[model samples]
Target: MAHASGMHSLEFKLPDLGEGLTEAEIVRWLVEVGDLVTIDQPVVEVETAKAMVEVPCPYGGVVTARFGEEGTELPVGAPLITVAVGEKQPTAGTGDTGTEGSGNVLVGYGTSEAPARRRRVRRERPVSGASATAGQTGAAGAANGRADAAAAPVDARAAGAAAAVDGQAGGPATEDGPVPVISPLVRRLARQNGLDLRELTGSGPDGLILRADVEDALRTAGRGATAAPAAEAHPRVPQTPGPALAAPGSTTAAPAEVRTPLKGIRGAVADKLARSRREIPDATCWVDADATELMRARTAMNAAGGPKISLLALLARICTAALARFPELNSTVDAEAREVVRFGQVHLGFAAQTDRGLVVPVVRDAHARDAESLTAEFARLTEAGRTGTLTPGDLTGGTFTLNNYGVFGVDGSTPIINHPEAAMLGVGRIVPKPWVHEGELAVRKVVQLSLTFDHRVCDGGVAGGFLRYVADCVEQPAVLLRTL
Candidate 1:
C-alpha cells in the first residue's frame, strides 16, 4: 500500500537480517537521490555477515535522500533512504507534502501497514542509569548508526509524540490496528516466547516491531528475575584498573599480525563454523573409493552425448542414492526442540571457491535432477559464485554438502560441517594406484572419500554404512542403477 497518497515522505531503514546480525556494509547503490523507483525496486546492495543481498524498498517514489557511502557500515534500524511517497519530484523544496506510501512492506525489508490500529509500546532514547543498561542493544545501534546525509521530511508527528505505529496521522487512529511488522519471523519469535506483540516497543523504522525488540524484552524480564550481586548493587569503586594483566614483575609484548574485520562473506563463514563446532558433537570418518568405473562411465556418456556430463554431477547422483538408503545423514539436529530435522527433498550444497571467499551454493531438489540437469545447474551456480552475485537465498538452506577437494589436488581432509546441516561428504584427489581387481593386480583410479557428521544425529555405524554405499556406487556405476 502506498503511503497516504498525498505529499508525504517515508523513511526507509536497514532491516535486521536475522541470526543476531546488527549491521551491513553497503557494497553499491542502485538508485540516485532523484531516481524514480517503483514498489519493490532494489535501491542498494549490502553485504551482511552471510551473503550479498540486494535490499528492495517497499515504498515507491522519488529518492529524496541517500544515506552512507559505498564502504560505510550502517546498523539495523538506521536510515538508508527517504522516499517521498506518491510524488514525482519527491525531494524537499517541491513544496509538496508527500505522504501516503503503499501500505505493502516486503518481508525482506521492514514495516507493513495493517488496519488494526494497535499502538506500539513507547520507546525513548536511552539515558544514564538503569534505562541505559536496559538499552544496551539500542545503544550499540546508535553508536554504529552512520548516515552521510540528512533525510527528507515527512509527517513530523509520525516520528514524535503523535507518531502512531502505522506512520499515519498524529494520534492513534484506531485502538484495534495490528502492530506494524513485515517479517513473519518476528511474529513467530514473539509467539514462541509467549510475549505479547501489543505491548512491546519496536526499535524499527516507523515503529515497526522487530525480533530484536522482542528479544530485548525477554532479556529485561530475565534480569528482573535475578537478584543483583552485592558488589554491583551498591559499592565503592576505584576509577583505575586493578592491573591484573601486567602484574608487578610481568613483561608483555605485542604480537605482529594483519587484522581483518569480521564482516561480509568471510564473517558469515566464520560464524557458521563456530556455531557448528559449538552445538554439534561432530565426528569424521573416511574411506578410499575406487573411481575407475565411474570415471569410465562418465567418459563414455560424454563421448556419445551432445552435452558433456561433469564428474561432480556423477558423484552427486551417487550421493543422493546413498542418502536415500541412509536418511539419517541428511538431517539436522534441532537442539531447542530436542529432535532431528529430516527433509524429504535433497538440497545439496557444493563448496566453490570464489573471489569473495569460499561459498557453498545449494542445489535445490538434487534428488529430482538427473546428471545432465545437475551439471547444468552446477555450471550456472559456479559462474554466479565467481561473479559475486549469489544471493542470500542461494547460499543457504541445504540438507547436506558435497566438498570436491579433488580439484584442489588434496587426498583427504576432515572438512568442517556446515552449521544446521547434519553432514558433509568430501571427495579427494583421484589418481592411478595399484589395486587388486577381480583377483588380479591392476592400476585403478582411487579417490579418498570423507564423511563428517553430527554424532547427535546418528552413530558411527550409520555414517560408515553411508560412505560404503557411495564407494560401492563409484566402483560399480551399475550398483547405483538399482536405486535409479
Candidate 2:
C-alpha cells in the first residue's frame, strides 16, 4: 500500500518575469490550499518589477499550500505555488508548464491567464412611447409597474411608465432617485430614441449600467402615456460614403495599407521598461581602462580553437567574478518590502543589437560556467538572438547584464541598468592610446568600461571597486585565471 501511494513533489519557482525584473508581488490567487490543480493550470498573478505576470502550475495534483498570498512579495527562485505529480487531462485555461521552473524564459515576455471569473448576462424589460401612452393615467401607472416587474430587475422601465401615466394625469411623475448606470448598448438604444441616460440603473457587474438597463428604463417610460417610438438606431452616423461596393464581376483592389498592433514580446518589453524606469532608483558610473590584456586573451582563446567570444563575454566572466566578491552588486531592489535580494547565481544578460532595437538575451548559470564554455554559450545565444532563433530559455534568468558599445565605434556610453539586477557593465571598443606601462608612457589597448548600477544597492566606493576589479581583469587576463 505504501509503495502504491508513491507521490512526486513539484516546486514551481518564480522565473524571470521580464524587463530584467527579479521579484514580484502576488496580486491574486485562483486556487486555495487543498484544492486540485492540473498541470499547466494558472495558479496566481504576480506583479513583477515591470508588469503583472500570471504564473502557471507545471504539474498536476493537489495544491498542498501556496507559498505566498495576495500582496506577498516573492523573489525569483522562491517557491511560488507547489503541485503534486499525477496524470490529469490537459485542460483549457491551462498555462504553459515544463521542466519544473526550468521552462523556456520566452526571451522577455511573460504569460497571461484568463480572468478568474466568468461574466453573467443580465436581463431587463423594454419600454416604448406607444406602450407608455396606453398604460398611463392611474391605470397606466399600474400597467407599467407590472410590465417592469415582468421584465426583471429594471426599475427605469417601471419609473418611465409611471411618468407617462402621470403625464396623462396632467402632471409629471414624481422624480426617482439618482440615475442608474446603464450598459453601453442600452445607452445607445435610448439615444436612438432620444432617451436620457440619467433615468436608468445598471444591473451589470458592480452595478454597471448595461444596455439592458437602459432598455428597461426606456420601457418603463413608455408604459402608460402615449409617446412616439424610440429611435430605431443611434442618432449619429457618418454621412461620407463607405468604400464603394465592388461590381459583381469586377476585381476589387484591397486597401493600399495595413496596420498591426504590437503584442507578445514587443508589448511586454515596452510595459516592463516603462515600469522599470518609473519604479527603480538608477545610478550610472563611467570609467576608461586599458584593455590590452583583454584583447590578447580574446585572440589567444580564439587561436586556441575555442569559440570566438566577444569582449562582452569576457566582461561577463569578469563581472561574475566581481559579483562573487561583492555579492551586493548582484542584488535586487524590493521597493514593496523595502528589502533587497542577493542572488547566489550569476545569470548575465548580454544586450544584443537586433533588427528590432536592443534585446538582452540572458546567460543562465554564468558564475558556474568556465571561460571556454562561457564563450561557446555566448556565441550560441547571441547567434540565436540575432537570428531570431532564441528559445524562451535562452533569454531569461539573468542576474546581471552587459552592453558593449565599442563595436559601433563609440568610445564610451553609460548604459541603462537592466533592472532588478543591481548593475550592468558596458564595454567599449579598444582604441590605441598612451598609457603608463612599467612607469613609462607607451601606446596600449585602452577600452572604456562603464558600470551602471542601482545606487540603492551600492555606493560610489563599492561601485568603483567593482569597476576597478573588472579593469584589472581586462588589463591582465591572467588575473581572471586566479579569480576564476
Candidate 3:
C-alpha cells in the first residue's frame, strides 16, 4: 500500500503551523536525500517565532529530493520534499520510516494536529515520595532509607546551617558531638564553589556552616590555587552578553560599556539582518507624502466598526495593492539558483514590537484580503504578539515585510531587507508640517516613506516607483476602496 496519494511522488511543502505564519528558517537537516524515513518521524529542525522545532515526515518512504538549503527562508506552500509514494514502508521501531524526506512549504507555522504516530510510550515506574519505601525502589533503596532515618535527629541543625550558608541566618555554635551536620543549601553552595564541606568550620545555629564559613572557604581556596575540592566542583552555566560595537556618529572612541544578551527573537533578527547586509546589494529611495486624507479615511473606517486601524494598516493595504500591480517587487531573487522566483500569494509580514523582541507575523493572502480583513488580521497578529501568544505559524511565511518605525516618532529609517524576499518598506512618523499646495503655504499632515530593496533583484527605479505608489494610495485612500 502507498502513503497519502497513490502517485510515486508526494510533495511535502511547508505547512502553516499556526498564528498566520508565512515563512521559516531551516535550522538543520536531520535526514538527507536517499535516506529512508518513517511516517511521523522527525526529519528536520526549523526555527520559528519562539523556539527551534523539529518537523516530521508525514509519510513513510525513501527521500527522492530535498528542497531549500539550510538557513534559507522559504515561502509557505513551496514544495520542500518528495517521497517515493509506492515504496514499501518499513515496520515501526525499525527507524526505517522515511523521516529522511525533503522539506516542504506551507502557510502556517504549526501542525494542525499531532501526528498519528510519534513515539512509543515509556513504562518507567513512578517515584514514591517517602524514603521508607526506598528498599523497594532499587539497590540504593536500603542505603537511602538508612541515611534518611539517621539524619532525622540532625535535620533541624542541617536546615539551620543551610539557611546560614544562604545568608539568611548568622550565629556561632559550640560543637555538641563529633558527627558533622550540614544543610542541603550549604552543601549545594559549597559544591558550586568547589569547596570541601569537611574542612569548613560552622558558625551557624547548632554549629553549622554559615555564609561566612562558605566565604572563608572560597577565599582560602582561591589563595591556594589548588584543584577544586571534590565536594564543590559542580559545573555552572551562566548567561552573558555578546560582542559590542561603538555607537554611531560618536566623536569619542569609547566603546559601548553596556551590552544586551542576544537570544530568542532578537538573536534571530540580528543574524538575519547581518546576513542580508553582507549578502544583498541594497538601494534605497525616499519620498514625502501628505497623509491628511489617510487620517480621514482611518476615522471613517473606525466609525464603521472596522477595528481601530492605524496608519501602518493603511500603508500595508497600499503595499499589497502595489505588489499586485508591480509583481516584480513582490518576487524573490534566488542567487544560488540563478533565477527570480515570483510568488502567487502575498504573505505579508509586519514588524510588530513586543516586550520580548520584534516579531514579524504574516498575513497570508494579503492581496486577496479586503481592507477590513487585513485590519482584523493585523489586529489579531499584533495582539497575539504583545501578549507573547504568537505560535510558530504566525511568525513564518512572508512574501513582503513592513516595518513601521514611525509609530515611535521617527521620521524615516532604512530597514534591512528580509532575505529571500527582495524588499522591505519602512513607514515613518506622521506630523503636521507646512506644505505649499498649488500656490499657497498651508499646514498638512505629512509622512516620510522609505523603501529598501535588494538591488540584485530590484533596481532603484523599481524601488522609487513602489514608494511613489504607496504615497499615492496614502494621499488618495479612495484608491484602496477601488481595489476592494
Tens digit of per-residue lDDT, candidate 3, span 1-484 = 1122322556576676555446666645555544445556666665554544566776655454566655455666666666554433443444343323223332222244443332111111333456324423431232232221222212222233223222233443222222243323344456545677778779876776755577677765543212211112122223343345535542223233323435446677888789988888888889999889899988887888735776566777899888887788888877788888889889999888764567788999888876678888999988777644566767777989988888898998988888767888888888999988668999999999888887777677777778888889988888776677
The local distance difference test score of each candidate is 0.70, 0.59, 0.62
Q: How should the candidates be ordered by TM-score, best one leading?
A: 1, 3, 2
Q: What residue runs in model 3 are displaced by over 4 Å at the alpha carbon?
A: 1-260
Across residues 1-484, which tens digit of lDDT does each residue of candidate 1 receive? 1133344566788876775668888766666654445556667777776566677776655554577876568899888987654433222223344344544443245333322212232332324565444444442343343434322122221133222222333323223234665343355456545678889878877888865687788676652212111111122232243446666554333223223455577778888889888888889999887899899999999999689999999999999999999999999888888989899999999999864568999999999999999999999998777655676677888999999998998899998999899999999999999989999999999999999999998999999999999999999999987987
Best model per TM-score: 1
Q: Which stretches of candidate 1 lie over 4 Å from their true place?
A: 1-8, 16-22, 33-41, 58-62, 84-256
TM-score of each: 0.64, 0.47, 0.52
Q: Which candidate, 2 or 3, has the higher lDDT? A: 3
| Candidate 2 lDDT for residue 322 | 88
For candidate 2, give the lDDT of residue 44: 71
| Deviation (Å) of 281 in candidate 2 | 2.1
Model 3 is weakest, by summed lDDT over 10 consecutive residues, at: 224-233
Top-lDDT structure, candidate number:
1
